[model samples]
Target: MIGRRACWGLGGLVMAMAGCGPAPAPQAADKPRAEAAAQATGAPGTAGAAGPSSTGGASSAAGGVKADEATKPAPPPESAFTPVAQIPEDLEIRLHPVEGALLVSTPNLTVVEGEQTNVATAVGVLKDGKIDFPERLRVPGWMVTVSGVHGRYPDQLDLIATGTTGRTGVAEHYALGAKGWDQRVGDAGQWFTGVARMGSSLVGLTGPTMIGRSRFVTLRGPRVGLTITPAPRKGECRGFDAEAASRYSEAEVRPEAFGATRDGTALSYGRNCNGDNAVEVWKPGEKRSTILPVPAPSEEQTTDEVRTLILPGPGDGEAWIVDRGVLRYQGGEAKKIDPPAKGARVLTASAAPDGTLWALTDDALFTRKGDAWEQAPLPDGVKARDVAVGSDGAVWVAAGGAILKHGGASEAAGAAPGTIQLQKGPPPKPRENRTLPRPGGPKCPQNLVVLYTFSKTAPDDYDFPLTRKALKGRTEFSPARFVVTRDMGQRFLAAFVPTWDLAKKLEERIKTDVRGSTPQIVCATPEVVRELKLDLKTGEVAK
Candidate 1:
């Protein structure tokens, strides 16, 4: 629709078109340039003009009227590249239907070199106004090509995209940075087939990385610990090569299709080794991996199959996997908290830190408790990929590539009667011994921690006096490092504690005496809590 020749590279979801030029004849590599590509997001972004000659040459005057006006040809429409957004900021999103294909990017003649200019504008699928990149390619748009289209996944934040220079039929490669809209630098021209994100680095699935011509690829990244087979078109990824697989001799061998997850400052990797389908799940802090022989994705299955989603719930030491529609744990049988919907199927699921579970379907997001499911209130027009619970029981979800979270110090999402909610407010006014000094930064003062529980009215009824009585001889109070909330809907309370050991002991006592209250509590230093990835339903901390 943008009126430009577009090339649909790999699977058509990613296309590069810049006058459909052929790669330059092999010789000296092209020189690297300072300028880069456009922003990846949809928002209109700005960049320096490619170069002069962008200025149209004046033409001869026409008939009688204004010869100068006729000669100027209204300076070429401005575009080294059209403005794009990599990822849009928080804004209302809509799922608009896409036409056959949408224009992804285009090239500018001014930026062309030796006749090549990698993708001036590539065309691909777009749905609901979102990039709608397929599952494993949730973060698409890195690979580009010429003559013949190939895909490549370079390091995260940086990638080489090849396209034509609109004017010349020569291919060019641009090294793109993932930060701001203008973070790009051109490189010696080369074609890339596919690219993917693993750890903080980007891994390429191109032939150049192949050892000689073998599918075995030695990529550039912090985790070169992996070697992949370059069968991008087939979407088939297997174990690392014999040489690379030996690095992890301590555990089962040959981990491939390594997917990453964050558990605090430490990053964890999940792999489905070729030797066996069992997935090895581990992070820095853990002594032994939580391995499960979840069947590997069959050749017929999509990339999501080989990619095991390792969810670590709050406080809970166990990690689990989701297969087909059931959950497989390291030591437990396949199970689902609730039965599948009558016609719909679950798309994603997660465990809450407190032992609750959540499932996502085409129609709704459901919470599970004791085998029963309840629909959580959510706006329409969006679908979710995964669910996460916060340390303080905040519900965080990756929906439509955006996070919709509930609970935590910030105002929580979805306020309805009978639903879980995190309570928060300005620091309580200082009074008597409660006038404790404020701790610098985002931590609770001294050894203090915060505890939470259900209350009738968070602000009105979270009696400091009543809480003091509850702890009786403990120094826990408001704004504890352990907790940062007080909500009204579910009557949430945030109680402070002087020490974690004291906090733990008091928590056990309160849970026992509170009995049916099933009050939820969360308290930990900001840094420790930040590293935790929890389940939305139960408060379990995920690995």
Candidate 2:
């Protein structure tokens, strides 16, 4: 059941960009100086002080805020925000709140839309947020929205926009491959959305009317395209939508074995159908007349039906096909490997960085090294649904809304898990525009927050010498900075401050408590916060 609960705990903090005018153009005389600064700081094309400043002071400022703020009683437990739901058994849910749409799918590729409560139509879901589909294509699976209108793949591919009446064009297509002919032609005026590439050949299927027959087309090159004549199937075998097809495109179906040579030609393994669950060998530049025999599963396995396939490395006729709980190596025959007993249902399979095949089950994770299968220890009481390996070779597991990262030694590896903390707090309220004068030292722009670094030599000295332009009045000049200290060796110390209203508050408290020594303030942008470097002391923004 869907539920809602208010978010609790220390909400993640974020920094935002302030409004600023366009930067001045650079002069010929300033070129050398700008280049030298870029070389020294390793920042290119950032001249005239128009771009964001460094984040060296961010960590110290955050630490300072924690040190000075009075301890407040913890708020009552929140019950209004529901945690993000985990993937259900046999069902994958994709939610796009910004577009007010949800997509639920089964392993067999059956998809249905959830009732949208919001007025917006959800287009696609993102790591940070969700985007809505344009009014042109109301069908969800037809087009995958990445970011903006231009954020589509292969610009040449024509997509359905809005019709003359501003309504979405509702059309369906079916892709069929027989012999010699491959065509995408359907009823003259209707639109269809099924197109995929098998090797170098493109296959498209379309069904114009719900009760009408479907047409199949194949395109080899720019000018060479074939329209297949359906051999007259008896019943309604052609009217199904793109979602009904067990396979769509190479982009959607994950490849198991690739670049393998069969009969002196390159071959790859791909899932055939949702019901058949067989992997077919695909060779480029081959005629559609060739048919490869489907391999059989081992005797211990009841289900020969493969769900997911993975090829560890470059090899001929070598691939790993996953059928239920067993991991089978496919060559001449399917050899099943005993999976970890603690594993529930296998969720996903992938080749680890070390060439070991790994699988994520409902209850545990299993890894195969050479011929031995080992079960990796999971966090106590945590159930996982999805897993992915990062470019850094670290494994990431997603359960419910929590994300855990595994790093370090083999035993220690996958042991320590870090949860993904999303930034929270009510969005900043809108404010009126106002102009203010520059202050002494490095003056931050109006609406810009600044981070200050305090010197350790004068640890007790926290007073800041403000220029008259910035001290006009509290109403006209209210700049905030957050401050914290860092240990540079045992004898030396550094402070980091960010450019924001919150940082200004820290500066005010320091000046009020400690007098004399002036603190240095620097600007920090939101990009620094994502780097995970903004802690209490070091001020390094997370990358």
Candidate 3:
């Protein structure tokens, strides 16, 4: 069952763009020594004999209302809000939906607008068709709203917020779980673009488009670290003769290992690029690896390297290598693990974060708890290639080249395991200004508009668009930044924002037409932009 409770926990406290306080108070020009005293109190006319003085008194002598007083926000109207948050007087908060954060930029003069990372949310209810908290929760910048469908769930949400800071000696944090959400997206300023999640790590993107060099939140442990670059690019698979000739060879899979699979994070190029010896394997952003020594080849073991599969362990920096038996590597040492079943040879093994070992044999799966290995259930006729366990201890298997996920958390969940199909290549770009009579799709010029969708499953109208203004520059393109959800669903787009201010009008115009509220000014997050793959020199997406 989906969690019904509101999971609002502070993901992290981020401090970016340090020392960027207000512009140093704007220095004044030097004055002549004779007139210095008069210039100090006069408005350039030099108050000699009550020149241009106010009716009540000299303007500088008795001040009633100051200039900045006009900018002070009026008291919030009465509402049903619970907490009376002390909104910052001089801070611009930006919620990066893909990164799942609310940021405070160097004091600016615009309203806060932005996005969040997690699809999990549970905003109570919406009174009318819209959420009223926008006015209730005071933020000086854009307030972003992310809603739409993720996989099979309708993760609808509506939230109104602005961020505060530690300098103010106050902090607020929230977390949304996999449960309910109020209908409608948040206020009209910032719009949610995309989201990525791995365990508790969440990333949100909000800008010209969800594709390309867009900004996103990157969570780290309890606090949010910084945004990161997209997947690291690897040299083509045809080189590496020099690096392989000397020492340890990388793990490699056969040609048939990744048949028709176009998406892969490169591990290491093979020696001589021949792929005959060491090959790169697939693992998440983990640091664990195994290099076990094997005895002379038997009839069953044709080549020693071919049978060696380095597997990641469940704990931090743990790993194992299996060649008919397991060699556990932990604490900077590799040791042999006693076989669980009688005379049973371990074929492949996987580690869980909790340090549990689940190994595959000829017939059954042996799980090691403490010192004992016990048999665990395996679906019949499923030829397993690799086994995996999530941070939450859910078991998964790579079988027949598909990811099978088993579940027992809820009774409504599947009895057996289920397969998750990954999108192989880049998803096709969404077409815009078509004759579809869409709210935001009121027939736009083909040359002026470009639309990008999160994935193939994205709704017909749920597409993000950019115009010539957004992409203005002597530019080309590159492969987008790929961010995956917990279900392996990918959201990507290509962005080359020459000047965020230049694209402001266009971003707001579309937000008004499609969003049905006020338009929003969307600035791409600078910190998260580096995590994307950019063709900076060429300014074109790689073919």
Best by TM-score: 2
Candidate 1 on 192-257: residue-level lDDT in tens? 332333444444322211111212122344643432322233221211233343211212322222
Over all chains combined, what TM-score does candidate 1 have? 0.30
Q: Is candidate 2 or candidate 3 better by TM-score?
A: 2
Badly placed stretches (over 4 Å) of model 3 are 1-309, 342-347, 369-371, 377-388, 396-412, 415-543
Q: Which lDDT values do the candidates have, in the order given?
A: 0.30, 0.29, 0.28
TM-score of each: 0.30, 0.32, 0.24
Model 3 agreement with the true structure over 311-344: per-residue lDDT tens digits: 4454454544454565554554546677666666
Instruction: List all candidate RMSDs to the true structure.
Output: 27.9, 31.3, 32.8
Residue 429 in candidate 1, Cα distance off native in Å: 52
